[model samples]
Target: MESTAIGLWGIPLAILAGAIRVSTPFIFVSLGETITERSGRINLGLEGTLVFGAMTAYAIAVVTGSPWLGVAGAMAAGASFGLIHGFICRWPKVNDIAIGIAMMQFGLGLAFFLGKPYIQPAAPHLPSIPFGFWSGLPQIQAALDINVLFLIGAALTFALRWVLANTRIGLTLRVVGDSTDAARAMGIDPHRVRLVATAVGGAFAAVGGAYLSLYYPGAWNEGISSGQGLMAVALVIFARWNPVGCFLAALLFGGAGALGPALQSVGVTSGYYLFYAAPYALTLVIMIATSSPNRPVPGMPGALSLTK
Candidate 1:
């Protein structure tokens, strides 16, 4: 059966599908930010990183004819961006947040300049799992075609939560986040830890970009990201820095983001573009509801400047 067989009732299914598709990038980027923030650093440049990653992945996939290789290239590019940010941030007087904004612009400019040629080239797409085998309806089966990276993102969520709770590396990150002096006393180099964490964060964010280009909406262009990287920063805050919470929050945001497209898909065309505001509105509400001068969110890292 074909996916077009569904009637008006397919709206929900379409939303579900869109949520899964849209949420994958959010899941990965938020997870990366969670890790970076937990280590007492923030990388707002991820918006740029995400865009550049999409370009790198698409270009590589086109040249190599392998989507997986494209993903690898994107990760590498992302890590390099992180490295630059980390190194620049090591100066005593440097402001990490400001640097992040600068990096974001730099990355966007570089990506646009380099990606112009690749925009017209075709690239291979990542594979997916046919999760609709049990469903008799074409819409159901089609909606359930799960991408491989989504599974990995889900796993990373739980795994990150567990690692932060139980592992030695997790302890080091927490100590660094709480206080650099404490980390130094424990013989952990805070700078090295943060650099490594930021790099890993960048790599993860890049994978999110790869998923964007090599999977859903599968192509390379300047606007492929739609501010997903920036939104993921808010997502990390909404999750209270919890990896598992990040995953669930990503789904919520994803669902909200999908509302417009879902409605349009079902022939409900009223205020179509307004639906994209769902995510931004939700983020603002979450931030406002959770924030107060007397009591801040519980899980914020001590060294984070944005919340502090």
Candidate 2:
């Protein structure tokens, strides 16, 4: 390992920077999962949607030479996947988890097959705001270079929280989440609500995927998502279905994810690769700490199958 000007100090700074850079995808995916779970439904198939979205985004960007259009295409593709999942799960005695798994397989297969062609093409990258311009240090500048999607995700966190707490739509969603019977009594359509919520959640997850390809990793490949879609489901639970909590949890996970690379940057490579498992370990620890056989997770929707 070679010493640089930054030396040992780079580890923490790199982790901090990586947190901001990496957390964007987590924020979007967890928020999306939170929204879906809040509506009394779970979409484990988001992994599929995420990969497919990345593929669609990259393909669109390559063809149209417009990153924004690629984003739209990804959203549409993700929503379509959600629509299929929702429609199938709506049938009597059908299992949502099983259907989700199948959908995930289908999506992965589809993305891999189609994404192969676009793997060699370079897509236009999404724009970023140089938040570090005020600082003279190149490290500071790189760390603070915030993406536009990150800003949107941050604003969306507050907006989603407010919408879930203070709006009529939020009330109806809560009613549906609490009980389908209650929703029916109140003239609300729980199935429709869940369908729309799942679609919206998928769209959000797709945006996260778009961010993965069009921004951070900025590439299209079968493994681009790196299980983020699946992890977001657990993240939603960790956040207790709260959007703000999702944001915080995402940053924590992002920091954990960045730990290895940060350590490596500081010449701490002896066991640096182990840090790559930090996020998964954190997830396991959180699950063990928070979960109990005697009681349900706090803030979990009453109608959620896991609660039963």
Number of the top-ranking candidate, with lDDT as the measure: 1
The residue pairs that clash in candidate 2, if any, are none
Q: Model 1 over residues 1-308: C-alpha lDDT tens digits?
A: 23357676688888888889999999999999998999899999999999999999999999999999999999999999999999999889998999999999999999999999999988989999999999888788878999999999999988998899999999999999879999999999999999999999999999999999999899888888888999999999989999999999999988899899888776778897778788988888998887777765789988777754
Q: On a 0 to 100 scale, what is the lDDT of residue 287 in model 2?
A: 81
Instruction: Score candidate 1 by lDDT.
Output: 0.91
Measured by TM-score, the strongest candidate is 2
Q: Give the clash count for model 1.
A: 0
- Which lDDT value does model 1 have at 267? 70
Model 2 compared with the native: what TM-score?
Answer: 0.97
Clashes of each: 0, 0
TM-score on alpha carbons, each prediction = 0.96, 0.97
